[model samples]
Target: MGRKSNQQFVQIPLAKLKERIKQLCGIYGIRYVETEEANTSCASYLDGDSLPKYGEKPDGWKASGKRIKRGLYRSKDGSLINSDLNGSSNILRKVARNLGIDLSRLGRRCLTSVRRIRLWATKSNLTLKNARAFTPGS
Candidate 1:
């Protein structure tokens, strides 16, 4: 049994974050297509010889001021990945905002936080799909 005070809750699903990430990347011509070098077993890419699709990135790609490994700018996509792993939070709020999600009750840790995302999608006449990550597949 749960407390009456905690009757309402919110949580962002992985599928939503995945779709939103793709939408944001799509704005810059970045495709979520996977690269051949990605590890099929783990569903993630390996630091291999080939350049990854959507540029999962590999050696020889000269990085700028950002290290391309952990720099926030280089890892803007990290916002998506992190959110996918951590669920809804302030980071998801930022990423969602970038994708025009326009959620008002962001940064709250609950089991029903996805309402605003759905609402925004509805109000904006947007059709959301289960978007894939910038990851490669078998």
Candidate 2:
């Protein structure tokens, strides 16, 4: 398939997935919020780094922690955090400001201790695999 056609095909299912997520949230009485994830991955939640708007970084702006590789982030305290978790924490920080949620007590250790789950789709069945707990500096 051509590139454009491939993207369209992918988008169709993504739209349906989003709709289904909204429906599930509604059924569970959970609020479905869509927040911009602009600089979430680039900023360090452990260091309380400022999250800049997408493409609007200030002059010489820098975060304390940085992505060391595809899946790892090096924090300011020389600790390693999962890159995905770091980004997710920053995204939560974005909405926490408006929701009055306190995240100051959150620490890198908690992030590293999270259990990772791997999901597999076999034919029409979905299987969940219990991935090992995330170890720091792994």
Candidate 3:
């Protein structure tokens, strides 16, 4: 006698299923249009070249083999002294200023997370002493 095979089927709720589908579509850049004509129009707008290829160096490939030079205010042990600010933070703030973003807005948007901002600040040579002095109630 042959052994019988067992199988099980599961059903998901429609709303949850739709939400999952929408997330998947967004990840894959799939546009769902209401009408057939709209779908055709959307298809024309898609860029076939935007998809990234596996194991390929992206456009504007450069190989200088140089590490990003750290800014002043970093200690010999790679910790920030009391005076260093992250190089990238300075650059971002400069760009934001050039683009006419308010200083308060730039401050808010430039460093969203304290941990990451602190790390960047330390890495860029913004020392703990300087950071505390600049920040109120540090």
Candidate 4:
């Protein structure tokens, strides 16, 4: 998260990656629509924050949750969830809004219980400490 140069380098290939995704979607007859993810990374999905566009946020707008540290987001109730997961949920919420899908039933348990699958060189190497290291908190 501290590597600005690495982020810039990654951005260089993003356009190409988008093009490839578009091509693949077209081939597979999958609908693809690129949506603007302005405040997705900052807004709290659990708190139902009004996710606005890049410059459309109201004055003094603030999320009920925030990224407390790298790869972690702290919710309004002091619960910590993966930052990427929170952003991803916000993105899905945006898409659902556009599609008029009802996600009102989705709750904290659904998000908190999500398990991340890791690929280790060997199964024995996946110790409890190492496994829990990447979870909500260390």
Candidate 5:
């Protein structure tokens, strides 16, 4: 049999992809406002609605910052309690520990990467993944 030749593929523009990524990131408390253009667009989008300001900062930005900070802090502390590991820098290590895996067996070099940390935070079924974002009323 011959391979089908009528298959078609659609190409999405980078700008469109970026916009979609920005939207998804927003839902996960990641602000893509580091650049001037992004900041302007974000500001405009936010101003268009009467959304309640949780504080002097946007909830998403604050949450992302908190997670980063927690992760870094946990990396420094040997203790890995659920609260401490909520958004700690060594989240993968914490998760492994929580699961009763021996870190020594895995070797110190086998800790999870940042990308994996994000994946765990966003997709893992672990209890730590259920930690609420540091937002008001959360």
Candidate 6:
């Protein structure tokens, strides 16, 4: 029985994940859109390939390995939603500043508690839906 339950829990359907993504974006007051149809590349180099030019990693050089599978979350206020940083660090910082929530304790922290951010969101009235399904640090 435990094995069966584990097997069932091992995979969450992509549809459910997408729905969760939308819910999460709604909480952040951001537009959630998966632009799978768009064939675009983010590039800076002339050859359209960004690599280690000097045989070493440059400043802020971090490899996420394969590109993170994330949905596009945009806000009119220009907030960003990054999966690597626990949803949206940009929004959190902005909200914290506005609400005077001291986050210095979490130095260079990307991931933040959902409760904290949710409280901030609630205070700002970003969404009307009751946020009960979100867990901490989601």
Best first by TM-score, ranked: 4, 2, 6, 5, 1, 3
Reference-based TM-score, model 3? 0.18
TM-score of predicted structure 2? 0.66
lDDT of 5 by residue, 1-67 (tens): 3346434555669898888999998999864542221221112111122222334445554211121
Clashes of each: 9, 0, 8, 0, 4, 0
Clashing pairs in 6: none
Please state the error at residue 60 of candidate 3 in Å: 35
Q: Is candidate 3 or candidate 4 better by TM-score?
A: 4
Candidate 3 lowest-lDDT run of ten:
40-49
Reference-based lDDT, each prediction: 0.36, 0.78, 0.36, 0.78, 0.36, 0.42
- Across 43-123, the per-residue lDDT of candidate 3 in tens digits comes to 111111121233454676432221234322332334332222232344334344345544443232333233344322344
Any runs in candidate 5 off by more than 4 Å, and if so which? 1-7, 33-108, 111-126, 129-138
Across 1-138, the per-residue lDDT of candidate 1 in tens digits comes to 578756776676978888898898899887464223221211211111122344454556542212223211212223222223122232333245346655553332322223333433453344333333333581
Select the stronger candidate by TM-score from 4 and 5.
4
Candidate 6: tens digits of C-alpha lDDT, residues 79-126: 333333432343344355455766554422233222333333454364
Error of 5 at 101 (Å): 24
State the lDDT at 80 in candidate 5. 22
Worst 10 contiguous positions by lDDT, candidate 2: 124-133
The segments of candidate 3 whose C-alpha lies over 4 angstroms from its true place after superposition are 1-85, 104-138
TM-score of 5: 0.23
| Candidate 6: residue 87 Cα off by (Å) | 20
Could you tell me how far off, in angstroms, the CA of residue 57 lies in candidate 6 after the best superposition? 32
Please state the error at residue 99 of candidate 4 in Å. Answer: 4.1
Across residues 1-138, which tens digit of lDDT does each residue of candidate 4 receive?
568866665335888889999999999998788888989988888888988987899999998898989888888988887788788778878888566657665667556656653323355566765877889855
Off by over 4 Å in 6: 1-9, 37-46, 49-138
Measured against the true structure, the TM-scores of the candidates, in listed sequence, are 0.21, 0.66, 0.18, 0.66, 0.23, 0.23
